[model samples]
Target: MRIRAATLKLGETFIGIQLAKIVESKNPKYPVGQYVTAHFGWRSHTISDGSPINGQIPALVPNFGGLPLSLALGVLGRPELVRRDRNRCWWSVGSHVGQIAKIKGCKVIGITGSDEKGRVLVEELGFDHFINYKIADVDKALTELAPEGVDCFFDN
Candidate 1:
């Protein structure tokens, strides 16, 4: 299989996919017309019995309510699950997680590689503040931005 062929190969990484059923399934939970997300690596096809393996479980794609289902693999998935508290500070915010943290009413500070990216994080993405790691000392910037320390670090 392509998965076996790619195993232990340098520069090869597991690719995530949105699976569409081509045949009928015995499990009612995964019907023939349903779409699911699986971490079947770079292979084009895979078989699963709906049991969790390698920390990946075939899950029913969440309803995005007119938003693209692709968001399931991005913002709407693991990034939304990162813990956030309203009274605490959130740091290392990526574009998606920064929006989520802001919605949850946390003091969000984002770190990006460029000043332009930092501006996007704060001005457009609803982050409270941002630091450009390329030019600034991360430790010093973090200290100044969040003196009480970060409560959640959403490392995307």
Candidate 2:
């Protein structure tokens, strides 16, 4: 979310997180030339004192052990625990939360306004089902898809 600070006033630099390598450092925890993800958006260069920005310290990027260093920016931030049998509305978070739910083994059901987005939800993102509320009867569709009743309903 540090990318593209929407609330900035005129002439203010946007604030966001980015992948950066330490060209120089006085701190031994983060040696010179170490790769780190920092929270200073859109700047080509920056200096960090290893302080916590929004409660996150500048972490020394670990040896990936075959993983790409670019993933250090956020792939590690996903939920470590895998849950199952959950559902949500895709429009609530642009299929992001629904995808995460699917990754956790949930029987996800996404709701959108168009068939294209719905297809992406069910086909590409691996959601169990989708409802395009624009044309279909939501109540009837819900009854057909979840006859046992929906355990969760994410309305946005």
Candidate 3:
């Protein structure tokens, strides 16, 4: 559930775990400078010596071939098919999510905290439109941005 680099160990209890970069070899699947999100604990490095299940260090850093490591802690690791539902639409995590949604044939409406952020969401991030929640009415903005209803909403 937690990545080693993001974790802060307070004596015995583990606090946080961010994604960690693995020492890569010439293995075709894993390249150098690539990161791996793992449930390794609250340390800068990961050691699998004390694992109860595997009882050994992993030879490879799981299946992290072509996707971004930041997503390994989340959705890209999930095997379920992306589906459209009432809850999947509306909130925007960032331009990355918006661009991904657009690439998946879904309309993306980003709601951000600033005008500059909104501009980035639309102009740079490839969002169909952006609603600035800071300076405008949220309800009205949502109504205007997504008049056709939300198909997916990611809060990041």
lDDT of each: 0.63, 0.66, 0.52
Show pairs that collide, candidate 2: 2-16
Candidate with the larger lDDT of 1 and 2: 2
Winner by lDDT = 2
What candidate 2 gets wrong by more than 4 Å, as runs, is: 1-6, 75-156
Worst 10 residues of 2 by lDDT: 75-84
Looking at model 1, which ten-residue stretch has the lowest summed lDDT? 84-93
Estimate, for each residue in 1-156, the C-alpha lDDT of model 3 and write its tens digit.
346434745565453333566564555554566554434554556543323323333333455576534344433123233322222123442454567667867666766667777777777777787666656776776777677754334554
Model 2 — TM-score against the truth? 0.43
* Model 1 alpha-carbon drift over 4 Å, by segment: 1-93
Residue-wise C-alpha lDDT for candidate 2, range 49-142, written one tens digit per residue: 8888767787777887876453465422232232222233555354766676567565666767788878978888888988887877877787
Report the Cα lDDT for residue 151, model 3. Answer: 38
The segments of candidate 3 whose C-alpha lies over 4 angstroms from its true place after superposition are 1-93
